[model samples]
Target chain A: EAGVAQSPRYKIIEKRQSVAFWCNPISGHATLYWYQQILGQGPKLLIQFQNNGVVDDSQLPKDRFSAERLKGVDSTLKIQPAKLEDSAVYLCASSLGTGNGYTFGSGTRLTVV
Target chain B: AQSVTQPDIHITVSEGASLELRCNYSYGATPYLFWYVQSPGQGLQLLLKYFSGDTLVQGIKGFEAEFKRSQSSFNLRKPSVHWSDAAEYFCAVGEGGNTPLVFGKGTRLSVIA
Candidate 1:
């Protein structure tokens, strides 16, 4: 089966600029996740979606970051007024459920100057 | 709180030699452990996982990991290293059945011919 798909493999933006990333999960997968992986750091979970509803987003910066999975299929993550610290690779993954291993996309590498 | 730690930031090994990467986690309950590998400019891929059964779990590409509940560790091992094995490896922990994963910084493996 096809793996998760993401758009704009790379992005560069100035600090305080707005940016958005898109993710298309695998077919028949019930769980979708977005993670931020900074250089020399592990991928951090930004949000998780089970179907069209959010399961967890405690780590998300509500003031500037927002994510949504509409129709229980495709998802999008947006960061307004980006910061230098936001420079990292944003990865999208999908799983059948929490019990199964995840399949990930190539990711979108974002650089905020 | 749940957290993961990959003690080694990087490791170097010669091709055909054995390899091992360390991972430790802290959590309140019985944790679900996982190991993932990420190649340059690629997304994370599941290498192995440990939920409840055997401590030793085999993964794709000649990888395996042993979960030690006593030490709260899950270390990845490969009997013979290959040049293609050079990549970043991440360890993650999860609580509940399908909760968001908590990940460690990662260990970058360098293989020499």
Candidate 2:
């Protein structure tokens, strides 16, 4: 099967600017997730969507980060007033359900200057 | 708080030699464990997962992991190494409910001949 798809493999933005990342999960998957992976660190979940309804967003920085999954298939992650620290890889993943495993996208690498 | 630990930040082994990557997770109840591999500029790919049934589980690319409840460990092992196997390996954990996976700071492997 075709893997999860992401757009703009790399991005560069100035501090305080806005940026967006897009993700398309595998067909028929019911769960979508957004994660942030900083350099030298592991990926951290920012938000999770179960068929368009948010399941979790406890770790997301609400002031700057927001995510949405439309029709429970494609998702987008946005960061407004991006901070220099926001430079990292934003990854998207999906799964069939709670018990199933996840497949990740190549990620959008953001370089905040 | 729940967390995952990768003891080795980097590992180097010669080609055709045995390989091991240690992963330790902290959680209250029975956990969902996973191992993911990330190539340069690529997204994460599932290596194996431990949900139940078997303690020792095999995955793609000749990789296997043993989940030990008592030790809180799910260490990845490979009988022999290949240069193509050099990549960053991550350990992740997820609890029941809609909680997203918590990842460990990956272990970067380097294979030499």
Candidate 3:
């Protein structure tokens, strides 16, 4: 079986520019999550989705960040007016259920100048 | 709020030597623990998890972890190290099903011949 898939393994953008990352979770997985991993730091949860509905996004920077999982399958995370501090790896993961182990994607490395 | 801490930022060991990576968690109640490994430019892979029952858990690639409830710690260990084991390892804690994982900054392992 194939693992979770993510696009644009690497991206470079300037401050104030917009950037988006795409993720296609494993088939049949019901839980999807997006995480931000800054250098020398752990991966922090940004948002979580159960099917097409959001389950949690408490840590998401709502003013600048947004994510969507349409049709309960593919997902996209966007950042507008990106900041230099936003330069980090964005990871996507999926689980069969709420408490199961997750399968993660290779992640997108975003560098905001 | 739940949080995880990986005390060591980096660890080095020679092949065939034993290895241990420390992890500590802070949570109000019983928390689910997990260990994940990530290779350079790759995604995070689940190594093992501890929910209940046996405190000692075995994972893939000869990895094992012991969960000490009294100390609020879950430390990963391996009897012998290999060159391929060089990677970053993360420890995480969660409330249970549907909850986002709180992760540690991670410990980078270096194996020398």
Candidate 4:
């Protein structure tokens, strides 16, 4: 099966600039998630979508980070006025359902200068 | 809230040697556990998962993990380490369906020739 797909393998932006990352989940996956992995840290859940509706965004920095999974297929994560601390690898993952393991994309490495 | 702990920040072992990476999770109920591997500039790949039924789960690349409810631990193991296995390993715990996972800080493995 085709793996999850992500675009713009790398991105560099100045602080306070805006950037967006795109992801395409595996076919037939009903759940999608966005995670932020800072250097020397674990991946933190940014947002989660069950189909097109959001299931969780409790950890997302709503003031700066936002994500949407439209049509319950592809997802986009955007960071407005990106901060230096927001510089990290953004990973996208999908799964068929609960108890099923996830398939992750290569991720978008964003560098905020 | 649930959490995961990977106590080892880094570990080094010679090739063809036995390897073990420890993972501990905190959750209220029977937790879904998973181990993932991430190479440089790459996304995470599922090495194995333990949902139920079996305490010992086998994963890809000759990796295996044992889930111990009494210890609240799920540790990954490999009988013989290879250079290719040198990468970051992460342990994650999640609630089934529509819920996102909580990941550990991760353990970095280095294989010496």
Question: What's the alpha carbon RMSD for model 2?
Answer: 1.1
Positional deviation of A61 in candidate 2, in angstroms?
A: 0.9
* Tens digit of per-residue lDDT, candidate 4, span A1-113: 89999988999999999999999999999999999999988899999898999988999999998888889999999999899999999999999875887899999999999
* Candidate with better DockQ, 1 vs 4: 4
Docking quality tier of model 3:
medium
Q: Write the per-residue lDDT of candidate 2 for residues A26-107, one digit (tens) a residue.
A: 9988889998999999999899999999988998999999888888889999999899999999999998754567899999
**Order of all candidates by DockQ, from best down to worst?**
4, 3, 1, 2
Model 3: per-residue Cα lDDT over A1-113, one tens digit each: 89999999999999999999999999999999999999888899999999999999999999999999999999999999899999999999999754577899999999998
* TM-scores of all candidate predictions against the true structure: 0.96, 0.97, 0.98, 0.98
Model 3 residue A14 CA deviation in Å? 1.2
Off by over 4 Å in 2: B96-98
Which of candidates 2 and 3 reaches a greater lDDT? 3
Screening candidate 1 with a backbone cut-off below 3 angstroms (N, C-alpha, C), the clashing residue pairs are none
Local distance difference test, candidate 4: 0.94
Per-residue CA lDDT of candidate 4, range B90-111, in tens? 9999888768888999999999
Q: What DockQ, between 0 and 1, does each candidate earn?
A: 0.76, 0.72, 0.79, 0.86
Model with the higher DockQ, candidate 2 or 4? 4
lDDT of 2 by residue, B1-113 (tens): 78999999999999999999999999988899999999999999998988889899999999999999999999999999999999999999987555688999999999999
Query: Which runs in model 4 stand beyond 4 Å of their true positions?
Result: none
